[model samples]
Target: MALTVDKLMNDERFSGDNVLQFLLYLPFGILLLVVRLLLALVLWVASIILPNKSGVRQMLSTLACWTFGVYVKLKGTRDPRCSVMVANYVSCLDSLAASHVLGTISLRKWKVPPFFASTLGIRNAAQFVRKQHFAECPSKPVLLQPEGGPTNGKGLLKFTDWPCPLGNRVQPVAISVERMFTNVTVHGGDSRSSFPWADALWFLCTPVTVYSLRLLPPVERHDDDDAAMANNLSAAIAEALQIERTEFKWEELRPRGRAPPSRRAGGAGDVTTLARQVKEVLPAVPIHDILRDLAKTRSVDVTITNFLEGVTPYTPEDTTEPRPSTSKPRYVTPAPTGVFPKSAKERQLSFQERKAQMIAEAKKRYIEKNGLNLALNNC
Candidate 1:
């Protein structure tokens, strides 16, 4: 879809780019985070004590959202007649805010406890039924996200048709999330790597996250074509949100050539450790440059290879002490005395030649040690 990594994910939103600024805010942010979390928890408990449909319960929920630094503003009126609402996916809080205003039950299937279901507007689906069951029973208004997953609010992902057939008239809601104090991403784009819990934690860390939802008029379905209906509704929501529609799906939002979070080793949790590993292989490469590539590739070997192959361009930083080449013995062998490489291409060629020479020498030593030379002469 020609979508860049930045469009799908905010890789540098909370980045420790400016060491001084991060250091200055770390202590204050943590303190505010703990205080806000406690207040939100108390409010949530109070809301649970009240009746579900009670106006007091909704007010308590609103207070809880405020405590959690989530501010929601609703623009258009929700159609009471339509029981199905479709919105573009952005964050976990989308369901929370929608539930707060529209009182809709989220059908996005979050694997959390029932206790958390009230707060998140999510339900855990058992093996037998989930959204399908909700679609059948039209008791409460059901909220479904046709994008299937979150994206950085730049554009709209192609919608899925599963939510289209839930109701004859689907309500299209355009949701936009913005932050205050710090310019953080509304949602972490990669679903495979980022979870709802992580997003919630970041929410507490940030000062405030504002959600603006515009409820469009109900989209009436004439033909029984779910795909066509979904597409038309998607275009409508995109126009309302003033964002372009992309052919990109949620699955395609993952970083290109990157491994899933579980498979990502050193760089997954501790990127600095992975950068150090890359630094060991390419001593001339800067730590920041190594970290940048590791953030994208999330692998020490891949970052090192990127530096060695010149796939990632960087100017060599001056080193106080010269270090020996640290490339693996199998892939790269050391050159003879006084030999040096002036360029990446020459260095690679030299390594390959040295590796070949080493292999040939190993073969000769094996033949000589095993008396194969004498045997060949006899033959």
Candidate 2:
């Protein structure tokens, strides 16, 4: 889907002259930068003097959203009384996108590196750092990005080991960057490297567009007990964002090979009692008939080894048919951190060798078990 109207605006027919149009955008770009910087400075000052005040911040954020030709559509409820909010990261525009939805103050990490320092939006966010005197504000709802950086829609970053001192209930807000307006003139990669101030005026006036925010239901944790609440809240946020838990794919998280003896037959005897009930209710059917029916009806693999306690040899010829060929697994290499490796040889290495070896190994295991691949080829 075309996320923004700029796709239509960029067509040559919209702008009269191809060569002169580029020149026209040059001045407008500078104007956008100036406006954004000035507004950011003003907000920073306001945050210091009147720390709890959010009216001006909300107004500016709303204006920024409007300047970008973005409209926020808030779903679900946001309690006016709530103090904490958390969300998924998409782009720098996420803060502006969530402005009207909750009118909450967005939280950023303690330090934003110098490379990303030029962003007026990010600069405006610096006041909320925990060390600052302004951080004590009681009225403002703290907005947090658990992932800590933009993902560019490739996939979600894991949230299992978040390092924040969370409150009772976290409002999980999901911001989808439906589209972006790319200024081809600024060829730099990533938001941090690019001069956000350079094209600010053009973005402000030219209507650089984005879409809305979808707020999921608020998640609450009652107990202060660490073990019970930690995984529960993590799982809740993952479910709300439609993030898969298996994405972690670590050894500890994977299902165990077999039930323990206690679970299987003795101690609690839950499994034994269930087995007895099943034996009483279900008729004794031959294993071959069940296997054949499953092979014909289901896409999953359920051989004799999958069910029976004792090993029985079932050769290829013994089976009625061959299994369908599955596609190769795809391993997506994470984007380069933009730092060069120590040597030229490192630069020459393929992504599989440089960063994706572990991911490839995991993909191989997944493919072996499920007859599916999740790897993507390099562009």
Candidate 3:
């Protein structure tokens, strides 16, 4: 199968592409959306009040899933001993559906309301922690989607090596979603990553999305290498889902709008060419300064961001020799002789004034270093 961005991403909108269809669905979708939000609020409150994994909590969660138009059908036996679950990511709510059925906590890094996190079975944990941590805790099996991001459910993205930290024996849970009237489950456009809450909103707006979850038997690590093990796990899940595994990575899904023209073309290109591009954006910035940052960042947007954010320190270019970027801000060494402020507020104000002065001085120095003043004089 051809592996284009469109093939991997569901580029379709929730409302059909046709103007008439979108207009017809708009009013009803909005009304249905409001009702679903209310139900979600109730579920959130219930999750907080009820005990963890209790019958009431589980029942409310199941009912919430049904109410939100997420119907799940479970198949195959889950290994009771496997604490870590490797699953294919289809939607942002894949974790929620897995939590409801398999009682697994999806590992996440973002901050969510404590109650919501618990209700959704989301935990913020280190990615490289030992498997013993997961193995001892059977109540909360950690689910790792090695693909790192969502796909259009047609193919599996290359599995990352992140799951290797979580033991050898992993229960592979395959989640496949079927949307009524629309094939699109996850919308793709310019978003760098999938937002769970945003995707959940679509779940409520849609007529119904059926999730067919097949829990395969636990896969043990026969291979010694981590990469080999990850590949083996990917192969197992891909075979179960009946989808071809591709070399396409999750990063490929991200829009390259932020990337430099050269980077967008495919390669980083020559360093001098990249530096000149940054120079075009910031003429006052010296060539050496731009080159120094380009070597580190290797992206036009990031290098420019660093300069704008004052993260990169400027070194005066003189004597035809390049100076390394110093961690010490140039303003720190040359302290102005003045009486120290006694009050906390006064001290803060004084600091701000000094910072402003520093910025002004840096700008003046930059102009002088690049001979911009000479150009202005000539003009």
Best by TM-score: 3
RMSD to true structure for each model, in Å: 19.0, 24.9, 12.4
TM-score of each: 0.59, 0.42, 0.62
User: Candidate 3 — number of clashing residue pairs?
Assistant: 0
Q: Which stretch of 10 consecutive residues in model 3 shows the poorest summed lDDT?
A: 186-195
In order, candidate lDDTs are: 0.70, 0.46, 0.70
Better of 2 and 3 by lDDT: 3
Candidate 2, backbone clash total: 11
List residue ranges in candidate 2 displaced over 4 A: 1-54, 109-137, 160-164, 180-208, 222-379
lDDT (10s digit) by residue, model 1, range 1-379:
5556447665455544555675687798799899988887786577567666547656766776766688889999888778878998877678788888877767534445555666666543221133455556554577878786777778988896755655688889999988744433444434533346766777887777889999999999997597899998999899998888888766555554666545666434577776776787678898888888765554454355456555678989987778767874433344466867799999899788877777766766777788774443232
Error of 1 at 207 (Å): 1.9
lDDT at 226 for candidate 2? 35
TM-score between candidate 1 and the true structure: 0.59
Instruction: Rank by TM-score, highest first.
Output: 3, 1, 2
* Model 2 TM: 0.42
Q: Write the per-residue lDDT of candidate 3 for residues 94-129, one digit (tens) a residue.
A: 777888888787765345677666666666453223
